[model samples]
Target chain A: MATFIDGFLWYFALAVFVIGVSGNLVTIILASRKVDLSVPRDSAFSGALRTLFSRFLPDQHMLSRIGIQVVAGYMFHLGLFILLFFAAPHVAFLEENILGFGWTAAPHWLFIVASQFAFLGIIMLWLYRMTNSVSRLISKLDDHVATILTFLVMLSGCLALLESFETLRLLHRFLVELLLIYFPFSRLMHAFTFVPSRLFTGAWFGRRGVDS
Target chain B: MSERLERGLSKLRSQIDPKVKSFFSSCVHCGICAESCLFFTETRDPRYTPIYKTEPLRKVWQQEYTFWGKLASKLGIAAPIAEQDLADWEELVYDGCSMCGRCSMVCPMGIDIAQIIFKVKTGLSAAGFSPPDLAETTQRAVDIGSPMGVKLPALQAQIGHIEEEINLKIPVDVEGSEYMALLSSMEIMYFPEYISALAKIFHQAGVSWTLCSDAFEATNSGLQIGNTEVAGVLVERIVAGAEKLKVKNVISPECGHAYTAIRWEGPNFIGRPYSFKVVHILELLDELLQSGRLKTTGKESSRLTFHDPCSIVRRGGVETQPRHILNAIAENAVEMTEHGAMNWCCGGGGGVSGNERAEPLKLKVFNRKKSQLEELDVETIVTSCSNCRLVIEDGLEANDMEINIVGLTEMLADHLVVDNSQ
Candidate 1:
């Protein structure tokens, strides 16, 4: 039964990750592709590549703007990664199905603490969105929806971690599955879209001679 | 109002207005974007805050939208839209603001205040709340074919005078020219020297280039005016000019908003991209330098810093090439800390250039740049855009700082190996 459960989770994770990541990436690619074909000869492809990375990837110029948000964003993401992948359940799947690399997992106390920190970070982000007019204006329905869903998934996951009940774990698993399924369709796809959007906006402007 | 504006006004209401319902409904006086504004930072006034700047249209939505608001406003239980409101907020939206997307950039929630501001600006333009400068400038553009109202005949006369002085036909639309060189309106008006410099450069490089008499003004006032109809019509003229000449390559002058309008926004606005390639003067010079077709002999002054135009840096992501172009021409090119996409505005961007009323407010907001100049410890500030030069110069004069606000080509053209073979 353990093997079956592990197999199911691994397959589920792979399928959803592939779909969600790729779908968002494709949208990003399409948004950038919607440029005039005639604009490229003025610039070098390499210039576009440099611009793409500098605009999106951590640059000194962007540091001041992204400041606290960047720290909070990274903190929550790191915590989620530890909890999601290094959890015993995820490790069982990883060992049995894919990586086959066994590593010491976080202790229960650490897991609980990390989860709480991630939750707090997410709340901070939510509060930020609610307060900032720019964020409020620009946010789409899907963005808010994704945020709530992700928070619920994290919240449920934390609750399940606190309990020793199998049913509670199953509830957490269901919420995670729903979130994973909704990820591609929702603004949670920022992980995929952000990079390409950066590339496209940069490349388009760079080609057009706005590079002063 | 002209017949043109009458038409523009009626059609503006039909545009998307996507979230009019929720946008007005969901605000709770949270001032997270106070520091996000270059204007607010300069003014330190609560009224000029980013969210407050957006209140005009927000109130419009409220009065036209909610039951309480509609009832109150209709019954005169609340204040109605007034001329003072529009006058006070014009700077908050246009002159005092750069719409740099910095606030959007810094927002932890990624709300995109800049987008809403643009939308409100668009709406405001329809209501004829556009500043006099932009309105007048557009009139001058359409009537005289350039914003400063330099008519074609007078421009031709000016070019002829320069031709007499320099003794070059200046190739005003030679039939077999390979490139149609576009000039921003500013270069054509106050700084005809840059136009001649371009001619000298082209002649030196042995490239066939021509200036179109009909489509002479490359500066699209529509972008500044927040009037898309005027922008669309102006773009139509540019496309028509390009097609008429059938040039393989079009050289865009080193104007920030002009490049954005013609090259980036042009393709998007014109609905389909052009058949010919558009190149900025920097891109063209970079090509010329790479090809060894042209060379610069002299060095620009030391301790020179670049001023990033809001249109060029923030909106266009044109932060590096100007520096590269400057570095090539100058002995020492120092970058301001807020250089490139993060750089502050020159206070003359968007539609603020032509406005007389916004001038004082413009200088007040531009004091930030004055501080940056003092910090950089630079004598000359070389910028890529014409309006940037104009505004930066104005700011310098206002603050009692002595600085020459020079354009990219005006400097590059100075080093031109003038092809005297004409």
Candidate 2:
């Protein structure tokens, strides 16, 4: 059971994630886009690049209105990023199974802190989604599924942190595999799609010489 | 599905290009766009949320483009879009949204919400679910060469009146002129002063300009109605007129969407680059001022403020020109709490002004502007777009707030240091 969960299921999930994401991206790239013939006031390339990073900081006027989401979004994304790449277990696993790399991992204390931030951020975001009328009205079943699935994966990984119990580690691996497969199919695609989305819009506003 | 629903869905599916796909995929329904939208903020109704307004198009994208959606549709598990769905979204896209692009600016994910809303409008328009008044107006534009049905005779009459008053020749169909000026129906019927002002300013600046007898109307009801074919036709008329007149530049009048239709979206609509450059009237004034041709004598002493027309300032990228011109002529020019690219709409853009059904709601949303004005306590509001000026005038009257609205060109002309030599 451990071998099946750790080896074949893991490979299967990774394949699905890779194929699904690539296929969706290719589909998007191949879709017909209207060619703009107007004389551009500014460079579209620079606009796209500027917007790619500029959107990381919320607009000052919007900061007060979306303070909670901004804070929680940063917490969740940064915390998850730290845990995914810098955590000891994740690094070790990636080195053995994927990247053929064994970079220095963050200390155990940092992992705990990062996990707590991720947990708090995700929880707050979900609660806000449920409570805020606009969010509640707009959020779909996909959002809830993605959030709960991510939470379970994170929770299982934390429970298996000590690696003292075989069952907990397997459960964590199973959830991780499930999440990998679900990532491309769900709103989790935002992690990758946000780049091109920003680029397209940035180029548009950039061509118009507006700081969007 | 009925034929109308099928046609609407097909049109929507066609609109689901790379940008739409990317935007939809990136959205996590965080609802941050809601805060940026005036309709949602003023009404506190979730239905007015910018992202929420894209439901019809989003649903089409999902059912047609996504993996699970395709599977569900094949399995008959997903609910297909119906005619009533398109019918329901008419008000949200047409009335609730001014297409001011404010939500587009504030979106954290960088989604062009206004662009998508425009695409959604195309689908609704194809489905024949648009406002009756806007549809009638578009028909008038198609039949009479003007949205308000302002014929060439009427424009010629207005021109004769302006020429008599200004004691100058208002050039009409003068071949090989340097600039061909286009006027909105509102400018001709409601504010002929814009024509007189243009004549005075152009004469003082020694700029050769003419009005195209064939394509004098700049306000595009097709753009407002979300029918690109009609929009393309309108743009082609201007292109043909400019080409025939052999003008080097086409000046868009002091109307918001007209500038958007002619300057920004014109070439795209006609599927080619323009033979001549398109310039907003404000841009020309600013240029003339910088070159020391157009000089102003004195400033208005009243506590005045410059209302940035959304299309001209934000969407059109003529933000600084109006301010430059205003500062040159006004003694006291205050800005709204939120101005420039982030300025609130006059609650009547994107064809909302012509939609009689949207009047009450338009007046209701004017509170956003009313409060902005009340906060500043400004006596006069000067704007570049005639549509915005009219809407603001209506808004002020509805609230019974005694504030005056003036066009930037007319205001600038009032202060022009008339070149006696010319």
Candidate 3:
């Protein structure tokens, strides 16, 4: 059971995630190419570059209105990013199994702090999604599944922190496998798709000489 | 499935370009767009959320395009876009939305919510679910010369009045002119002073401009109704007129959507570039001022603020021109808390002002602008769009706010320096 879970299922999840993500992205890119015949007043490439980073900071006028989302969203994504690549066990695992090389792991205290931020932010955002009228109205089954799955993955990873028990490690691996399998089919795709999305919209506004 | 539902689904499917696909894939359901929308902010209703308003189009995209959605639909596990869904969304897309694009700016994903809503409008229009008022107006715009049913004779009469009052020719159908100007029916019917202002400004500047008798009406109800065929036809009328007169440039009058229709969406609608350049009147006036051709006299002594119409400032890229015109004329000009490209809509654009059924909701959403005005505590409000001017006037009156509303063009014309040498 241990070998199957560790070897077969992990490889299966990875294959599915890679192929599914690439397939969906290819399909999106191939959907339809819209050509603008109108004269452009600005360069689309510069606008695309600008928006890719600029959107990380919310507009000043909108800060008061969207302070919570901005704060929580940034915390969640930044924490997840740090823990995913820089955690001690994650870096060791990536060096051995995935990339065959890894950078310096974060300090133990940093790891604990990042996990706390990730857990807090993810929970807050998920709760907000369920309670907020606008999100409640627009969110579907996929969104909830994605959020719950992410929560489980994070929780299992926390339980495996000691790494003394093989069962806890297997549990974290199992939940991560589930997440990998579900990522491409769910709104988790936003993690990768937002770049192109921002670029497309930015280029459109850029063409009109509007910095959006 | 019903034929109407099928047609609507097809239209929605056709609209799922790469951009729409990217937008749907990237949206995390953050609900930030809700706060940006005046309807949701004013009413606290989730249905008015900008992204939520595109549910019909989103469903169609999912069912027809996505893998899981396709399997679910094939297994009868997921519901297809139904006629009832389109029927339910008609009010949300038409009456509840102004397509103001404020939500677009606030979207962390950079999703153009207003553009998506416009695509939703196309599907709703195809399904015959558009409001009867908008439908009737579109029909009138296509059959008659104008949405307000202003005929050539009516325009000629208005021209006669302006001519008699200003002692200017108000030249019509003059071939080989430098510029051919188009008028919104609102300007001709309710605000003929716009034309008078133009006449005075043009005479003072010594610019060669003519009014095309063939295509004087600028507002394209087809665009307002979200019908491409009708919009193309309306655009073709202006193209034909410009070609016949051989004008160098066509000036869209001080109506917000009219400027968008002609300047931005016109070429795409007609499937070709115009022989004559399309310029907003403000753009033209700014250019004249920059060239020292158009000069202004004494500034107004009252405290005034400028209302940035959504289509012009936000969507049309005429953000700085209006301010230049306003600053040149007003002695003490103040900006609303949110002005310029990020300004809140007057709650009457995107055909809401034309829809009689949306009047109350429109007034409710006007509270956003009302609060902005109350915060500024200004007496006179100056805006460039005639639709905004009229709608803001109505909202002010309903609330019994003793505020004066004036058009920037008329205001500028009043301040134009009398060039005796010219």
Going through the candidates in the order shown, the clash numbers are 8, 0, 0
Stretches > 4 Å off in candidate 3: A30-32
**Which residue pairs show backbone clashes in model 2?**
none
In model 1, which regions exceed 4 Å deviation? A1-38, A41-66, A84-86, A89-106, A123-160, A163-212, B1-37, B40-93, B99-129, B310-325, B416-422
Q: TM-score for all predictions?
A: 0.72, 0.98, 0.98
Model 1 residue A110 CA deviation (Å) reads 4.3
lDDT of 1 by residue, B1-422 (tens): 45434433343333324233323333323344556566767776656566666666666655554445677787988776664565566666887666666654433333345656766677667767777778888877777778877777877887887888766678776665689888876777767887777777777788888888778778887777677667877887887887888788777777878877886678766678787777777777767767878787787766788887766666665566666667778988888887776677776666666778778778888877888888888888888777788878778877889777777777877875544455
DockQ of each: 0.08, 0.79, 0.74
Candidate 2: chain B TM-score equals: 0.99
Chain A vs native chain A, TM-score per candidate: 0.70, 0.97, 0.96
Model 2, span B294-355: residue lDDT tens: 88999999998988899988898999999999999988999988899989888899999999
Please report the candidate that would top DockQ against the real structure.
2
Error of 1 at B413 (Å): 3.3
Give the winner by lDDT.
2
- The window of 10 residues in a row where model 2 chain B has the poorest summed lDDT is B413-422
TM-score-based ranking: 2, 3, 1
Can you tell me the DockQ of model 1?
A: 0.08
